[model samples]
Target: MIKEFREALKRFLVEICEFVQERDISFPQRPSGKYQVEVRDGIPSIQPIGIKPKPDLRALDTLMVGLRAWEKETFGNIMEIITRSERLSQAFLTSATGDLISGNRTMVFPKIRPIIEAYFAETNSFDFQQETFNRICDKVEEELRRLPYCSKILQCPVVGIHVSPNCSDCCLQLESDLQVRSLSLEEIEEFLEYPPFLPSFFTTVVEMKKDMEIFKQQLCFPEKDKKRIECVVIALRLLFGDRIFVPFQIERGQGILGKVLLGEQQSYSLEQRVVPPPRLLHIVDQEKYTELKELYHCISETLLERDRAKIAFSDNRSKQRVELALRKWSEGLDQVSAEWKLIAHWIALEGLFSPSSRQELSFRLALRGAIFMEEKEVYQKLKMSYEMRSRIVHGDYSPDDPQLTEIALTTEEILRRILRKILQQPRNYMPDQLEEKLLETLTK
Candidate 1:
């Protein structure tokens, strides 16, 4: 397989070199326009006045055809092996190829043109191309061998957290594999270079560039390993009692020409208007960092057990109910509105506590939850929150109502506690066992 791949790579490089030679001969000689860099409010943008003759793309088309044939004949088998080992879908390679050919900001061929041009500067020797091809093959083989063991690192922009400056790297190592670290100078400079367009004339590009500094810290984790990390984020929100979240993430270590690949920004409802600003950045010292790590483990362990249960009993009703409840909880975290969040949380609670029927839902929910938690006040709190839930759903409550905020917070805490308890010993909280425990409590 390696020998075949090396041969194909050599052929591809030879074709690329020939195409470059041919394209340069056919290139237009006359200058069509002068390009200038214009700085507006401290943002530099290229301004081109006249139309330049288009480069002959026929050579590029021929090279692409050869590349496609190589992919089908040789790379396809290697990709299959990788897919099986990585548990990636069939579309993974296709998506990667699409990104290489038609990425928004950069394309692979154009970016590599400079390096190729430098290689052929002195002489277009076949021996030099062969040396280049051999060097590339060596690197490609090494990469293929390491690919399965390697994982993509995703740097998610985290709001409402900062690392203490006294720390060595300004990073908090949450786990061996996960960390909260300040963005590197390269990443910050990249942000400044490509500032988002102003939403209005009122917001200047310079002001937007200043706002980019708000992203001081990021949550770093393996892209494919986000399940536990996601639980950790939720745990952080629960611990801080604030809207600490990841708005967007960028995949690192896959840059072309010093430009990193940008991930999609999360869409928000109209009510959100804009991504919520950082409230108060909490500096994470050692003690607080330890606390954060421990809470993350607690939450992640529960989720891990739930996943195990699902795998063990794929069609188990109890497992299915727990899955639904967990989904609702995650959806609640995604919601920007307190009302929607409260509703989503209540639905999750229903999946956990009221799996069978909605008969006497309020009473059963409050009683079962309170007894399970071993707190009498929980019963009253849940009962009141259930009433508020009814009012919100019925469209009788005002969004500005002070009780809305209070109930949202209270219900979130209650639900978080309940989930943690149930997840700690999922078998004990299965529907039948839970009902038995509630009956025993009532009898007592």
Candidate 2:
């Protein structure tokens, strides 16, 4: 009976993190009252309920009285309890051996008497234990009742880590929808001082509180990273809770097919590159039109080679190359300054010759670009592109920089050349090795 009491007392105290030696205290098998932390209909409640009381034992009745008094004073400090209850439990433990064993030295182990005489110096001291406890419970219930029911979950599959090109190498673009509960970009930076699972050394240049189509960024993950994908999904669910609805479009031709929810919780269709709907060619100038016609076929044949790869790894490898090629191809269409386009072009070209310095990377890509195009002018444009790139980086961009258009076209021409080479070559798409072989062949 004593051992059972000790275990129950130990569980109760440790659950509240107020640990004490259970062996030093004794509990009644039939507790008179209970203070319970109960959950009803998804809401938490700390309720006090009366329990069956044991009869015919005066010492157990004393223990019950002490427990009820302790519950009444629980409104005070979490650590502080009814002082008498502690003394009662201790006294009950000692009563088992009686007062005769105080001076006897046992053969197996020495039984030492407790040094402290009493847990509370004055039991006669009076305090308002019950009244204060009732007030606290009332106030707690009132506040909890006023809170909004959390029936819906609010979660944001927050895309926090954005790695763009070197122009913004150390810079990060914080993206999320602006909402009342959205964690600020600055708050995220402080949180990353001890990141849960991502790198944290990047500098903040511009913070976007909530502007980007945030859900689109999640499409970057593929099936190979399903575990990592789940981790991110779980993290978002935790940070924002269940009301998270990520609505994004899966491109199909020029029109919307319908809407679908995107998350780990539901089944999602794989994103496929769509074929553009048929349209008539309208070229004002017939000369450039024919040139573009041939260029389309050349790129198409290259794409065919890219599509033939059956392996998952190679498919991803080629997908990245094609995406880079398309991005570099489209920069000429962006409504930005020539210097901005130059910067964008240089970044796209980094895949071919990835070195630290922009100048070296530009030169090497230009060398390969020139070799592929069989045009000496591209090499000169490559050199000039680097000089202009530097001016833009240092905030010394000149609007009237000579030959800006020529340089932009030459940059586009080089990206085209790189893509064509990848598709035409029998040897698989290997940019890193291609850079080495090209450098060795050109220099020697």
Candidate 3:
């Protein structure tokens, strides 16, 4: 295997040198000679008097520059792939060179065939055996995680996917069993930002939980360890997608965020003990698994887009556009309600109707889906909520208004249901396209 790998490396190096040589020869020589000016219909055009090879074209320095660029690009690609798995098990990383080398003939070459073909813009020019390639990779994959970091085995991420069906909460759990290994302290700290925890994040408490551990063999786990574990769980949820319900010590506030899983039909909780339940995996019904896969993908994409939108709004340039107003609308979409902010959500949801006027907004929003359209009462309620929005925008309504709470609740629920349905569309849509779809639904 080592010998084969060395030969492949040699071949790669030779090809790289050959590519440079070819490029050096192919560098079209610049048109030579002093410029001669001519007048063409009162416009002056400059032309080269003689065409000759570029004097510096074959210089040693020129060759060196091209070779350096080639090396950087080729080697940079390999390093980029390596960097992606920096948090992977040390054993797997350390063995990467060996694996790549051994698989050079069978695995690496076969896997890279598509890339080579694409670069050449020809597919069948390269012959890669399907069965042989699959077998080679399967073997390596099996051996890849054999020596995972034992002390910290990452478990698959579990997500409580936010769902609303028939205008009711229909949230379900989606557990994807996958794991990652040790990252640097800085990296782990960065991960803590994902959970609902404020000031400090879940993964950030991991070390504190470890310090609380007692017993020689680390048998006795502290009571507070559950929160720390939940922090990791929550971070997993963020890295993946979906709501994660991690039990926190009573001292920590709010078990759920924004009423997530507030009225779940089947809530699963793990006991806080040294040895809790072996696992609480959420298995989708075989019949519904296909839909769950698509739903999960939708949820993941929407959350990612939301994060990007948040980051964009943070930029001062974005704030100067009409988007500044839209940003306010989006803020209320996911933001935890505050006394002063309640009315904003009411106005925000109304704008999703892509209204030509205040009057048309309610009808358009209602027409968006059966959740509101089919429920005539829901449609009326939505219209009423928009009227409340008018009061706030017109300075007639206050957060302290007695009816504000009910109106706020109605708007928030509608926003969640409507947004969830929009996200679940078979294909992804940007905000404008989504608005178009809302109108298209009414016509259809």
Q: Find the candidate with the highest TM-score and give its number.
A: 1
Question: Where does candidate 1 stray beyond 4 Å?
Answer: 4-8, 15-152, 165-168, 173-177, 184-186, 192-229, 252-279, 294-323, 333-336, 423-428, 438-444
lDDT of each: 0.52, 0.36, 0.35
Give per-residue CA lDDT, model 1, range 1-444, as digits (tens).
556644443444454445334333222222564333233443323333476334333433432233334332223322222223221111122233343223443333233332233222212233434544355344445433432221234455566666666765677666665677766666556543433332211100000000111111222333336565566666666566555665444444332322211222322111223434445666667777676766666555455554323223223676666666665775676666889988998998787778467688898888778877889899999999999888989998899998888888788778877765655555566554556876786799
Strongest candidate by lDDT: 1
- What is the TM-score (0 to 1) of candidate 1? 0.56
Q: What is the lDDT of residue 9 in candidate 1?
A: 39
TM-score of 2: 0.30
lDDT of 1: 0.52
Candidate 1: worst-modelled 10 consecutive residues by lDDT: 203-212
Q: Write the per-residue lDDT of candidate 2 for residues 45-119, one digit (tens) a residue.
A: 333456523333333333223234443233221212232345533432331234322222121011111101111
Q: Estimate each model's TM-score.
A: 0.56, 0.30, 0.31
lDDT of 3 by residue, 27-129 (tens): 2223443323233443322233465223332322421242344333332332222233233212121232333222222332322322221222111111223
